[model samples]
Target: MKIFMKILGIAILIAIGVGFYFRLNDDVLTGDRIIGIAVLTSAFILMPVFLYVRWKGKRLKDYTLSEENLKKMRDKGID
Candidate 1:
């Protein structure tokens, strides 16, 4: 439940970011409406993946996939 809320929050922020980006430059943009919508849709969709990768990368710096980390107990030995 907490993870779901976090993801939802991330998604809303991304949506606002994308909306602001487009709103600011809408006048300069030139293309068919269909093409424009397609671009925006894909870009919005990509934001979540980008965020996930960023989050995972940050977590990786402080953690590892070794057996010790997997067990998540300080007393456990990797071997």
Candidate 2:
């Protein structure tokens, strides 16, 4: 399940990456109206991806920590 989620995330990331490529291809954004719309559409698909990857937890209590440091902090009553 985790791997599946990761793959889905990767797929979105790749789409965003491709969109970024088109978004930055400004020379292609010449006077042609059709080319401009297509490029903008590809780039706009990145908005959902940006939203997904950066979705934080609802509150501070749900944070995660690395195992080694979590243990050390646990021993020190910090976690």
Candidate 3:
């Protein structure tokens, strides 16, 4: 599942790059292209990466402040 997501994310990113290339090269800009880019970026790129990492047992709290983290920070003079 994780491998599949990684592949999907890469594919989406490539599609976005291609979309931008064509849109920028053209003389006329359309609302559809803008909307398509926005939706693809969020749904395909961001969502897949988020889900893949979460599925790997990573938690948001692990990176945020907690008693153990605070204590470590203080000891390291970073607090």
- Full-model lDDT for every candidate: 0.57, 0.56, 0.71
lDDT for each residue of candidate 3 in 2-78, tens digit (9 for 90 to 100): 78667766766676666677667772265347548756777867796776677687777779999999999999999
lDDT of 2: 0.56
Off by over 4 Å in 3: 27-38, 44-49, 52-79
Ranking by TM-score: 3, 1, 2
Q: Residue-pair clashes per candidate, as listed?
A: 0, 0, 0
Best-to-worst order by lDDT is 3, 1, 2
lDDT of 3: 0.71
Question: Whose TM-score is higher: candidate 2's or candidate 3's?
Answer: 3
Best by lDDT: 3
Over 4 Å off in model 2, which ranges?
27-79
Better of 2 and 3 by lDDT: 3
Give per-residue CA lDDT, model 1, range 1-79, as digits (tens). Answer: 4466467556655655665566667633432343455456556755565666568637563576776566665556544
> Which residue pairs overlap in candidate 3's backbone?
none
My TM-score estimates for the predictions, one after another, are 0.34, 0.32, 0.45
Off by over 4 Å in 1: 27-79
Q: Specify the poorest-scoring 10-residue window by lDDT in model 3.
A: 26-35
Our model 2 lands, by Cα RMSD against the true structure, at 8.5
